[model samples]
Target chain A: MIRIEDVSLRHGQTQILHDIWLTIPKGGITALVGPNGAGKSSLLSLIARLQPLQAGRISVDSFPVDTTPSRDLARILAILRQDSIVTSRLRVRELVGFGRFPHGRGRLTPDDYAIIDQSLQQFDLTDLSDRFIETLSGGQRQRALVAMAFAQGTDYLLLDEPLNNLDMFFARELMRSLRRIADENGKTIVIVLHDINQASAHADRIVAMKSGRIVADGTPSDLLTPKTLQAVFGFQMRVETFDDMPVVLHFR
Target chain B: MSIAATKQASKTGWVAGLTLAVLFVFSLCVGVDDMPIIRLFSDGRALELLLVSRLPRTLAAILTGAGLAIAGLIMQTLARNRYVEPSTAGTAQSAELGILLVTLLLPSASLLFKSLAASAAALLGTSLFLMTAHRLPPTQPFLVPLFGLVYGGVIGAAVTFVAWQADLLQYLSVWTNGDFSGVLRGRYELLWLGALMVVVAWMVADRLTIMALGRDASIGLGLDHARMLQLGLIIVSVISALSVVVVGMIPFVGLVVPNIVSRLMGDNMRGTLPTVAVSGAILVLGCDILGRLIRYPYEIPVGTVMGCVGGLIFLWLLFRRPSHV
Candidate 1:
């Protein structure tokens, strides 16, 4: 479980996140959805400790994120940011192998390699294992990056906008993979998603943010309503039931 | 790594080793002195000349080449820009400033103390560059190197102005134009420090490679990114400072050699570092040989030779493809 208390972030004169207090329980997929500038990404970065917290307390599984050694925290949480640029020309397998760095430092044991192989297989990256990352398409690269985080073998995965640049098929495929990992492995996933329908269809719970504050938090069925969408996005959204799942249609 | 890649890497290693050995022998043999190759074994005077002049000069060239190349590699990785070499990033200029300051303030300081001062100055300069780089917009990657070049030019100009006012312009010019003609047994010992830095860099190769994944990924991988960055900066500072002090500023060797090696082999520093080091040494040896042969007794400076060659290559690299930077 990840816990946040009174987190506030300011960039220059602008406040990015204001008094964000949220608790993400263990062993489930929770999707954070918001409009642009709603601070969804900022909150994710804060929880992952990618950005330093100015006024907040965050803990993952009873370990304070600020005080815990990075290596110790890495075993409990792994984050994949949207703009995690890899400038080095590394093979896909090599990139995934880096996920085991927290465990082995640099020298990988046989067990670590087995786990790496499992991660590659889990993401269907076996065929592209030896390919350079720059050669892959955007969706393939996104999958590789996610696979790298998965290979870390952390109990909690925090992904910020993983669906960016992904086609509809790859986006659904990635969401399904995240769902499967959550159900079978009992790994907790906190993902920031832009597509509300995807969140409604795949996520167990949806947390909506507006103006840097959490406005709604509940199951997809409760949160994905026309009135709630209007409050969060400041525009009316059409919500329809499809196969017992509430699909948000905000495009029109 | 696959079996084929491992085999290929070893093959490259063996070939590079053999070439370096051949170049080392050739460098020792071809000098201004008329000592016969055969007489090197039998004649004491010829052997002394080889030991005192040719051998030290060859070793100095090799060390400077390897050190600057490795320094450039680290800087490029840290800056996330291929064009950020020691000279371009103002590290060499900062070292020059240190030399000028030491000459004025502590006229009788030991060579070791002078090198340390220069190393400290290089560290300061590189840290400043890193801070400025961190604040720049990442959308235009070319701006990073452009900023470095401009920043280095400002530092270089300031050093030159101070040297002129102090009536030490001649001294400054000699150090600025890198030449191995002054290298002898006693003069080239500072390069050993550079060799030690290379060894240290090799030991931390994996950590350095991990750093290339950028800040978020490095931290995500449990690396103390700031500490690793500081370590890399220190290594780069020491290497750049020592090379500048020992051999003067050998431009483009650092930038060109590492870029070529990275293009051929991937950026896994553990796998590619030795090759980068060896290639740097070979390039310097080859250029020094060319410089010696080009003008005979009136030898051109290796720095000038490398500037010409490296400049052409750099321009080609800039225009060759539409890079991310």
Candidate 2:
């Protein structure tokens, strides 16, 4: 379980995250949904130890984030940031292979290669494995980045806006892949998402935030109501049942 | 196709290595005193000339070429810009300042002492450059190298003023303008240390490439980004400073060779560094040879030749990155 307590962040006088407490259990998909500047990414970053804990304690599977060695933490947790720009001309396979870096001396054994191959297959990136990342389309490159994170073989995966470049079809496919991984592999996934429908469709639990505070936390049906939506997003959106899942029509 | 590319890369490595070896042996025979290939074993004078002059010059040229190229590659990786080499980042200029200070303060200091001091100075200057560079908004990647160029210019201008005040203009020119015409056995051995540093670079090539992925990604992969940044700066400084103290500053070996090799071989540093190093040797040795032959013993400095050649290639590199990437 990942536990965050009294976490707060400030950049100069501007507060990015208020005193926040969240506990994310192991072995399922948890989605963080919020409006712009809702501190969703900041909360995830703190959980993954990407940003240093400014005023609170965070522990992942009993390992205190700030105190534990990074190498040890890396084995248990993997994170994919939204603004990852790979300037190096790395082939997709080589790029994915870096996920194994914390495991060994950077040389991949056959078992590691098997894991890498599996990750590539998972993301539908096998065909593009040999292509340089620079040559990949934005969506394809995003998949490669995701494959790299998956190949980390960590217990918990923290992905901030992984669906940014992907279109609807690919986005659904990626969400389905995450769902499968959570079901079969029993990995814990903490994803910050802009698409509430995808989160409702795929996420096991939804955590809603506004102005650096978690305003609602429960299953999709509990959090997607018109009253909760208005309280969280500051706007009214119609929520309807689709295939027994609450799908919000926020565009109109 | 990946297998084929791997095979192709290995093939390229072999061909480059063999060609460099042959050219090295051939360069051993190119100087003022004509020592034919057959006479070295039979003639003592020819053997002396070979050991005392041709061999050291050839080795120095190759090592300087290889070292500067690798330094440039590491610098670019650390800076995350194709345009910033050690020369552009104030590293080489700081090394010059080191040499000048030592010359004024300790006239009797040995060559080894001078080179070490220069390396130390280069390390400090480059470290400061990278630290301040960290503060610049990363959205404007172009600003980093431009900042480096201006940073290097300020250091260079300081170096010039110091030299002028001390009436050490001639000494400054000798260190600034790279040449192998004066290389002899005892004079150019420090570059062997530079070669050893290249091996160190190769050992950490994977980490270096990881570094090119930017800070968050690199740290996410369990690398201590701060330590790796220091290691990179040290390697770049020591190598570039060694070349500066040994043969002055060969401008483009580090800047142009890696860019060209990366264009061909992608940025898997472990796989591409040998090719980069060998290609650097080729460029420097080729230019040194041209320098020798162009003036027909009257001689142009290798630094001058590279400034013209590398400057042109760098212009192409500058304009190419945005459109190409």
Candidate 3:
């Protein structure tokens, strides 16, 4: 379970998050959806301990984020931010192998190799394992990065816009993979998504944020109505049922 | 994508092997006298010169190259940018200025004092850069180097102004050119400290690699981000300053060598490190040999040759598609 308590973030009189309190459960997918300037990324960063917390406390699986050792936190939670760019000349296998760094350091034991290969296969990147990351297409590269995050073997995965740069096919495939991981492995996945329909389809719970506070949080069916969507996105959204799931038609 | 090409390519290993062999042979053969390479071991004075002078100079070049490359690798990793290196931080120039100031202040200062002063100055310059630019985005890697270049130029101009006033420009110019000709048993011993740094860097390779992912990534992975960055920066500054002290500023030995090696060997800090060290040694030694061959009796300084070569290569690199990025 991830718990955030009275978290208030301010950067020199500009408050980014205000008294934000949220409790994210241990399993299944939780999509953090919000409009622009909603502080979704900042809140996620604080949860991942990417930035120091200014005026609140957060804990992951009973370990306090501020006091926990970095290695310990890394083993517990893995985060893939949208703007993470590595300019080093690295092969896909090597980048994925870095996911296992906290466990084996640099020496890849047989077990580490197994995990790396599993991650590569899971992301459908086994063929491109030896290829340099720079040579891969954007969709392929995004998959590789997601695969690396998976290879970290953490129980909780905090992904900030993991679907960026992915094509429709790849996006659905990625969401499916996350769903399978969540269901089969019982891993806790928290993803920040821009596309409301994608979140509605895959997310077990949808949390909507506006003006640095979560305005709504409930099951996808309960919280994804046009009324809530209107409040969250500032526009009316058409909702329909498809195969017993909510399909939001917000394009118009 | 190019693993097949990498497997088929013998260029890297071949270059390393050929350069090492050529440097060894030339260092043994070429000197002040007309003593043939075959007769050196038998002749007493020739043997003395070979063991006492040429061998140490060769080792110093190799060690300095290795040290500088390691320093560059650390800096690039810490900054999370391919273009960053120790020399880009005005470290080498600061080190030179520190030595010059120490010499002027105390004419009878010990070699240790001069080196320590240079190292402290380099550390100070690096800290100043960090303090100023720490808040800026790391994507603009060139800003630090540009700042460093301007800082170095200012120091250089200041040194020149002082030297001109004191009428010691000739002495200063000689030191600045960075010739390894004076390296011998006692004089070159200080460089072994840089070799020690190479070992230390290798030991911390995993931590450095984690640190390369950025402060947040490293912290998320349960490492002390600030302390790790501090440790890496310290290693970078110390090695760079020490290398400058051992052999004057060998331009681009840090930037070009590590970059080339990383492309061939991939960015795993462990694999790329040894290659960078060897490649740096080969490059410096090869350039030094070229210097020896061109002016046989009157040696052109190694720094001048390196500067000319590095300038051309840097221009070429700019035009070419960056392999690292």
lDDT of 1 by residue, B266-285 (tens): 78889999999998899888
Give, for candidate 1 chain B, the lowest lDDT window spanning 10 residues: B316-325
Tell me the deviation in Å of residue A179 in model 3. Answer: 0.6
What lDDT score is found at residue B226 in candidate 3? 83
Clashing residue pairs in candidate 1, if any?
Answer: none
Ranking by lDDT: 2, 1, 3
lDDT of 3 at A155: 98
TM-scores for all candidates: the values are: 0.98, 0.98, 0.94
**Residue A157 of candidate 2: its Cα lDDT?**
94
Q: So what's the TM-score on candidate 2?
A: 0.98
Off-target runs (Cα >4 Å) in candidate 2 are: B318-322
lDDT tens digits, residue span B93-166, model 2: 99999999999999899999999999999999999998888788877877888899899999999999999999
Candidates 1 and 3 compared by DockQ, better number: 1
Q: What tens digits encode model 1's per-residue C-alpha lDDT throughout A198-226?
A: 89989999999998999999999999889
Those runs of model 3 whose alpha carbons end farther than 4 Å from true positions after fitting are B1-18, B131-144, B165-168, B322-325
True contacts kept of each: 0.71, 0.70, 0.59
DockQ of prediction 3: 0.55
Query: What lDDT score is found at residue B142 in candidate 2?
Result: 77
Instruction: Give model 1's DockQ, 2 decimals.
Output: 0.77
Candidate 2 vs 3: which has more TM-score: 2
